[model samples]
Target: MGEPNKIKLGISIGDINGIGCEVALKTFLDNRMLDFCTPIFYASNKTISEQKKRLGLEISFQGIPSAEKAHPGKINVCNVWKENPRIQFGEATEEGGKFAIKSLRAAVNALKKNEIDVLVTAPINKNNIQAEDFKFPGHTDFLAKELGGDSLMFMVSDDLRVGLLTDHVAVKNVANEITTKRVKDKVFTMMNSLKVDFGIRKPKIALLGINPHSGDNGTIGEEDEKIMKPAIASMFDDGHQVYGPYSADSFFGSGNHKNFDAVIAAYHDQGLIPFKTLAFGKGVNFTAGLSKVRTSPDHGTAYEIAGKGMADASSFTEAVFLALKVFKNREEYAELSKNPLKKHQLKKKTKAQ
Candidate 1:
């Protein structure tokens, strides 16, 4: 185990009944993980221990009172609550949601307070996690409010990067939500993320059509022609490498997404369907354009395979790696930006289109 600048990684145990803890815990069992960052899980030691014992895995971790006490090259469990919630492997209960929120809130507070350098969240059940206090659809919305930036749900892998125009919305409401401002906001957010987070100076961006055959040139639907095209053109004219309203039906199957650095989809499924198809078990959902860096596994809570030891930790592991990578990139970018000449030159080059 090696120390990585003593970077403290804050983790939120997503759903108590899910595979979040299993995969997250499995990822760190490899002592090599300590080479990259120190990790702190925002959950009770008892809760984590119960899951570990249920899965028959041995992990050495110390219980800490808060993120400030996290040790380098060691697993630190921040006890948000001392009492253990009921361990129903596949069942979603109010208790699960309550405790999950407890962990998430604690972790987010730690993140906002700068006690942790970055965050990699575990999977949470969307419906179960919904309540009066935590009424948002998912992490992106919650983080946007907490972190304060135009957020984009960026799905990333070695081969592809996809950002959504709108995520966690209804089909009917999606078209209504796809305004020019939103299209531009999410795309520009992705572009900036590509530059600053992924370290791509010149990133080519693509947009998939909201309608089949890209509205068949106004025959299929007007969203592609009316909404997406103008946004793409505006960004392009502003000196950004933005293009399309390409037919979504054939975009991925025809291998068109490989042509660009990133692709923007009209909605959640439009982006995630192809993304998951091509990179399931390997993709990481990065909440780009936020004040704090947060990433999660592409897949959600695997309730069915919660405790059989069948859950794959690949995506969760990638989330950790990505959170670290982005943190380093942002650090390097910030340092480079300190040079006024370099900063001015970069601004002139990109120019916020």
Candidate 2:
């Protein structure tokens, strides 16, 4: 077992044919990571062994039947499935998606049972992963349903944090989905996440406009003025330090986003396009508002470079690091909130008087 203070990180191997296993194994290769958390990978030994051989990596993993048997100081692989599916690198097959769902479901169950402190999921093929058992658009949606909360797709890095208003929606339908209530809920979620998960006591959030030039006063579109502006006003009236339906075109160009603690964009591409451009290979996709902590790399399954031994593992490693950081921050924030020093401060002031 790891130290009492150490966290237990549960990992779900995404598409078996994707870079999920590659990145997971590569990230755990650094022995120093074990000092902070014990990792339990929800995958079979056969899958992990195949990937290790294909990548020609020297790392070793301990195969266990469940998270309960996971040992510290070693990478643990919990066998979610016994059958070994064909490893087709760079191919999106039904078998690969099936195993990905199996791994994810198993890890999510462990997370719900409190066996794992945090979850770091690898990328999954959104199309092939669809089944009657797993019908959600992506990880964020699936987690929101399973964990019973309105989750926000919050992307984070050292310098920037971006959250989406409407995730995994088509471009044509993005505007219709941007309702006053939706905007308000997303902003509230972002504000709470900034304080509780990131340790920001008072957060300033920026909201992006839904249209070109922010609708140019309705010449291009009116969603920015009609829906977005009112939502910003409502949040402000509620005492949140939120601002702007800023023009997406120049928000990042002028670097105004640096002034705020977080940004909320109207759609997936509106937010993620700039985020990936700024922190593509190192960004972490954090699902805020869930009862449990879950993070994943910002990028998707790289079918082109799945087994080339050239896939960059920076984003995946950063996801794990961010998960650990957020978990610690949440714990500290909880303790600080539970035993506030306001009473003590007042007593000290009385003594001085």
lDDT of model 1 at position 89: 89
Q: On residues 95-189, what C-alpha lDDT tens digit does candidate 2 reach at each position? A: 99999999999999999999889999999999899998778888988999989788999999999999999999999999999899999998888
How close is each model in CA RMSD to the real structure? 2.9, 3.1
Query: Which 10-residue window of candidate 2 scores lowest in summed lDDT?
Result: 342-351
Q: What lDDT does each candidate get? A: 0.91, 0.90
Off by over 4 Å in 1: 1-4, 340-353
Every model's TM-score: 0.95, 0.95
Alpha-carbon shift of residue 30 in model 2 (angstroms):
1.2
Q: Give the TM-score of candidate 1.
A: 0.95
In candidate 2, the residue pairs with backbone N, CA or C atoms under 3 Å apart (3 or more residues apart, or in different chains) clash, namely none
Clashes in model 1: which pairs?
none
Query: What is the C-alpha lDDT profile of model 1 across 1-353, one tens digit per residue?
Result: 44546789999999989999999999999998987899999998899899999998899898999887777889999989978689898888888888888889999999999999999999888888888778999899999999999999999999999999889999989888989988888888998999999988889999998888999889987888888888889889999999898889999999999999999999899999999999999999999999989999999887888888999999999999999999999987898788778867766777765
